[model samples]
Target: MLTYLVSPDDSALDHYPLLGNALAFWRSTIQQRQPFCPACRASFAEEAQPAAFLFATAAIAPTSASVSAFCMACWNDLPPAMIEREATRVLQQVIPGGRFLDPCEARR
Candidate 1:
């Protein structure tokens, strides 16, 4: 898998969608179709495949700290920067003194 980012034109992004956080995607695959990395775009399995692969990224935004990671098969193309942004976005929505709920660990 490619360990670097591509410098494709902005238009390439239009053709290639960016998959968000991996865990979120996994939980809602039916809601959102998975995205393929532009560098790895392939239509025929018989043909060669791209060397680039995506990965899952977990981070705390604003603070910009990573918390977890997973490979493309297990995760989506969530970069560190994107993770930070998503984390910070979540933190923003959580009320400081409001009621919050955490699922039971046994349930998982």
Candidate 2:
């Protein structure tokens, strides 16, 4: 797997060389084109000022990747523990039977 960071200011073509600059190809084939808040199903079409982006490393795969976004209200109302719990819950649905390691456990 390849990992590259694309800054908001940087062009997608500049970063994803492996894609061979085929933005149209990637977009056309990509499923679930629209992103939404997992908890509230809020449409994330525009930039959310106070959003929480959760990357489920345990659920990362070529076929299925997991990213749970939470809106400002959910992010503000929920405690940190609750947020993590919810993210884990959502990820588990996407990655059934997938093992999730704690950050400390992964480090060691």
Candidate 3:
């Protein structure tokens, strides 16, 4: 499985070269004030404050791709094992034939 750390300190493309469009989509989502959690579909605007973090993922294959986002709370509440398992599950649903091609270690 591929892991990426999306934060203010790092460039998304540097970690996942295939995430250029996905990053752009996430930026636009944030700019539009419509960021929502993919797992719960909770609106970020209702949080009473800006999101502490934006956890996003893109499942890409030669012919298919999809992107999703998660709020900081939901992301942090998950255990490391759960995160990997859920990420893999989400990726499979998004891109059925795609296998992660990026480095496996989390890029901090």
The lowest-lDDT stretch of 10 consecutive residues in candidate 3 is 48-57
lDDT of 3 by residue, 1-108 (tens): 334545433564566555555555655676476766655567754662222233334333432124455566657676756555555656676457654444555343
- Over 4 Å off in model 1, which ranges? 1-76, 95-108
Tens digits of per-residue lDDT for model 2, 1-108: 222222222465455443323333333443456666666666655554325545433224444233445778778787877766666667667666544466689789
Root-mean-square deviation per candidate: 16.1, 6.4, 6.3
lDDT of 3: 0.51
Sort by lDDT, best first: what order?
Answer: 3, 2, 1
Q: Report how far residue 71 has shifted in candidate 2, in Å.
A: 0.9
> Cα RMSD (Å) between model 3 and the true structure?
6.3
Angstrom error at residue 30, model 3? 5.7
lDDT of every model, 2 decimals = 0.31, 0.50, 0.51
Q: Using Cα atoms with residue i matched to residue i, what is each candidate's TM-score against the true structure?
A: 0.20, 0.48, 0.49
Q: Which segments of candidate 2 are over 4 A away from where they belong?
A: 1-32, 46-50, 57-65, 97-100, 106-108
- Compared with the true structure, model 2 gives a TM-score of 0.48
